[model samples]
Target: MDDQTDSPDDYHAICLGTAARARGIATRYVDGVYSRFHPFPSRWLALAAGGREYLFASGMLLLKGSDPWRGLGLHINEEATLLIRDKQRAKDFLDARGFGTPAGRVFRRGDLSAALDAFSSFAGPVCVKPNQGTKGELVFPAIADRARYESAVRRVAARHQKILVEESVSGQLIRFFFVRPRVVAVKLSRPASVVGDGSATIANLIEAKNALRDRRAVPGHSNIVVDEDLRDFLAMTGRSLDDVPAAAERVFLRGTSNGATGADSLGCRADLHPSYLDVLAAACNAVPGLNLTAVDVMIRDPAAPARHGNYWILEMNRNPGLTPYHFPWRGEAQDVSGAILDAMERGFAPVPASPPASVPASTHSMPAN
Candidate 1:
């Protein structure tokens, strides 16, 4: 079923549902319902008949099959899932467990001066983002100075009441998608980029890229927009969209590696260091009751240990989209969605109960249908 936080035409839900049906399970999309709250209208889907049904208001999956057997949404229980939604809270939990995360502080809408004060001691650029944002919205990867930082703060603060300011970490971005205790999929993620062919301007390259991107676009995927934000990002790098570069040179179109922003995900599960498996497992265990999580990490080199303290855990996503790993633009395809269903059929022992006051009713796990 579709929910407010997700698009009614969610491709992840579609792919997973198809996978389920291929295994003899039944599934179908629920009719579309409109709402003024979302930027655009969205819908939900469900299994027409099956062993059982689990309905959630925040996610797009409506599973019905294998009675008495249930799949946790992304293999994450409701409590831990909600806990990880707050970036600050999730960072605190991981930090306490000895998983090294970037040092940062949370600032409310009115606290710009304090944020600036905290940034003064940081080296180089800073990352500013909404505390509970997803799909890379309002996440500024690099705010180089107080002027830019303040501007970003004001812009981001208007939409999000809480903001996170952290020292910018530089490196290749990698995501470890874990299924329970094991790392099931790994991907190298990058901001949307266009390669120059020695003949076309950057703007022309972008248009060409968009042409191809639109042809393959799904519900969550999108064509890159050459908007003011992208122009500003280019200006900061001493370049312009009208500039042309040498053949094979790549120009990044945006700072955030969000698929909706046209970021690319390349499968790299086999390329990860062996040591990373254990370290990532520790990262997952940091959150109690969390069975599935996508851990964002940055590293200077792929051949070395990412746990050397220099590398940082950017964020944790409990309800991570699975299609990116399943059908990457480059690299090998992984069956991350299939793995999720596999974990669900295995069953989850009840977790230690969380305090009632800390839990929200809307975040409650659905009963088996």
Candidate 2:
């Protein structure tokens, strides 16, 4: 939206459309709202050939077909999306089922006093964010005092009625993009940062970094903004925009690790430890009707084998962005768009009756550490 060459939604649409066309399925944009597909019979179509509809946010819809709709990128359903969108509900569900999640509590508007009281109970730093928010908007992480805690609560409360206050877990933020039976791609993200060049001030370094991002013109990537929040974050570390950082010294510009906010995304699917696969698979399978999702996990060390109380599930994304995997700031690009289409095609195929197998309960546990 900030004069970018292309938005994440636009990039995803292009990738999906191209993949669909390659599969011999006619695809065209209808008023730039959604994709119209041919050879599918659906009442929502303007012509007889219109039977399938695909949107980046909402999943695919099949008109006059055996399956009516596939929510959240043609895999997750509406119920699951709604559940995942509400951070409190989703966290409760996962935490109850032995999935490691941050210990936190939710508060509604006008409950500021109670929220502050609960904040004091935490042993270490905490994260304050909207209960139902995305793209890391209005998320304040690593808050350690009463003053910052109160300010974060009031600020977030102004925009959202519900707020979630959770313990801040220290680890690398990794996103596991799970497509039903397997984890297709993994992304490691870091907060917006700039390395010091000795002579240039922080402000100049940020401008230079933004210029590089602009030149790269990577879809879905955003420039690091020199804003009040960034300035405040620097102030907390006793630094300012005018100060010159020593050469090779890296200064983080933000607390939230979001790609849209200039955070760096790196493809790490191949680097993920094998032990995490089981943990991620069990977590994804825990949610019924949730076939495709992006599971955000905080790990102290991803290279090491996963163990209980070593990681925490931050949240789950229903319609996870595909462009990040395809156009990361660093690392190899993954064909996530093609994988979604393949899953969609498989979903539409006739199902053969199979014996129902018992689902094993999760054995993992998260102790308060």
Candidate 3:
């Protein structure tokens, strides 16, 4: 049955409609109308019917005998890669697919000791983070001493029941946006610092930082007040409001921070570098189930991305922030919605029509020609 409904919430359906329109195909969106009809076998109810029987239909209802119910279409799907949200599983899957991903290990909470020992073989500080965390919420790194590592572990453990510890990596933080296997945009989040004049206090410096941040585009890190970590960082350095850093003195509140600081980041390196395609392809193959996942990758260097070494994939995002694709930035469309629609249409459509079986004489009288 042809269906048309007005609902902006159904992104998949909307994309299908948009794609169909772009391709010059006549299409309609049907929402909730299927429930109005009796749930009888489709073949019985879908027999070619007279126009009078469908007088109340919003659009033409294809009968089983002739139409075979193949016209149904939808916008999104449950099977898309968007459903695969786990961190370690995503990495293993990506690595198997030949994607240049980080070197690390995943273990259950009980087995963290062994995992830690295994990483000790490598020379470098290790980072500890929660398996599922928003932004850099539970991420900490560059920890060498065992006591500090234990402290960080305790703090992280208090917040989360489980955590992950891996080798510390030094590189540029880049977010590669993807829909399924396609890369749409590359955003480089550089760990940057800003200096303050001698006149402003540390508090005032932060306030000025926040004032310069662009709220409409990227939320400025400056707007985010000093957390416990920032406070501790300030205290350990023995600096207060009176001491002003050298003019344009670079001060880093976050060691691995690349996103917005106090000011909105300029589009200094907005374009995607040409070298990240191989890693992107490997990431897509790694998670076969994900429909759309943004792979958070760390490259030692972008100019020599591959030459530097394998790009470590921090994690694969399942439910990515969607606005960046079309709203403010007008990022490229992966057209994943269209792919979902195609899958839904093929999946939900009824079995194709076959030769009608010869039936016994009907009890009802047949009209004589």
Candidate 4:
């Protein structure tokens, strides 16, 4: 995960997925984890603009990674970084909206010592997460003490250009997928999810997650790390997967978003929610230029409904994935992609001019020859 670049596999998948739908090709989404085992030519990463870029992979981090066009799609992928790559710029926008976000303190490890005591003053249990690392690989959240917090910062400092100690909010984790002005899907995430048959152990449940190679296993997270935090949570609850965690019951993951290793996505259509729509509309106007983003939010209590009063905007995903936002099964909710593709094909709504003139300029200029 380079700061200036996106993971090749992640970028390539988006491009191919987008173009495949656009071109009417026999579309086949590939699994990234399994694909890595195959052979390929030299990998490439580049920036593209103004047209549909294409690449392949059901989506995974394949090492023998063959698809050479990964780099070529970087341009379209740049849309994703519109709100992410520049941390300061993103935080400033969120802070202006009256939403509580990570009170990120950017500093070198050496200077952090002097600022340590003060930083903890904002809130206790600050996290030392790399401004760039993926998953929870390099993030050290919950530094209850200053010494330990500083140490975590130093470790990260060795590798990163800067470190961010974010304010930790503990509660049910939620992720909201937005495509510009429209919020496609909002899911309440479980850090890690597994079904219980009243027999399998926690480890067994993990095995079950890993075993489903064909469908359930998502790329970038094919394997679950039964790290110390998970162990501690299991112990704290005085329970194990053997205790028969409720059917569709979630085993809580400590220090993570509902132990959600990406499974807690519950589809929500803000357009359908009246009260929430008001908030979304306000937010859209505030960030006028942003289109297509998945914003993470922490709703102290979400068991009720996704009505206003409780919604808080987290960071935005300029290029949110279409799969999670779309309905996976039959007849539940409208698939987000169907709407997005409809918009993409039917074309963006004609932007009315300020004076309501005879006709406004082309809203989305078609790609050049």
Best by TM-score: 2
**Stronger candidate by TM-score (1 vs 3):** 1
Candidate 2 residue 142 C-alpha distance from true site, Å: 0.2
List the global CA lDDT of all models: 0.69, 0.73, 0.48, 0.48
lDDT of 2 at 315: 94
Q: Estimate candidate 3's alpha-carbon lDDT, on a 0 to 1 scale.
A: 0.48
Q: List candidate 4 segments past 4 Å from native.
A: 1-83, 100-102, 115-119, 132-137, 142-148, 193-201, 208-221, 228-250, 257-264, 268-274, 303-309, 326-334, 346-369
Best by lDDT: 2
Residues 29-70, candidate 4: write the lDDT tens digits: 332222232334223222122233223233211212223554
**Candidate 4 lDDT score relative to the true structure:** 0.48
Model 2 RMSD in angstroms: 6.3
TM-score: model 1 vs. ground truth: 0.83
lDDT of 3 by residue, 83-189 (tens): 24456555565554445555555445665566445445557887877765655676776677666666666666667656767777777666665644456555555
The weakest ten consecutive residues by lDDT in model 4 span 360-369
Per-residue lDDT over 1-369 for candidate 2, one digit per residue giving the tens place of the 0 to 100 score: 112122235665566655666777665443222224322211121111234444443223322223344221232344465678889888888777677889889998888788778887899999999999877999998888788888899899999989899999988899888877677778998889999989999999999999999899887789998889898888867899999999999999998888778999887766667777778877776666666778899988888777756788999887677778888899998877777776666663332233125444456742221
**Residue-wise C-alpha lDDT for candidate 1, range 175-220, written one tens digit per residue:** 8887776778888888889999999999999899989877876444
Runs in model 2 lying further than 4 Å from the true structure: 1-9, 31-53, 57-75, 348-360, 365-369
Colliding residue pairs in candidate 2: 40-51, 42-63
Point out the worst 10-residue segment of candidate 2 by lDDT: 39-48
User: Against the true structure, what is each candidate's TM-score?
Assistant: 0.83, 0.83, 0.59, 0.61
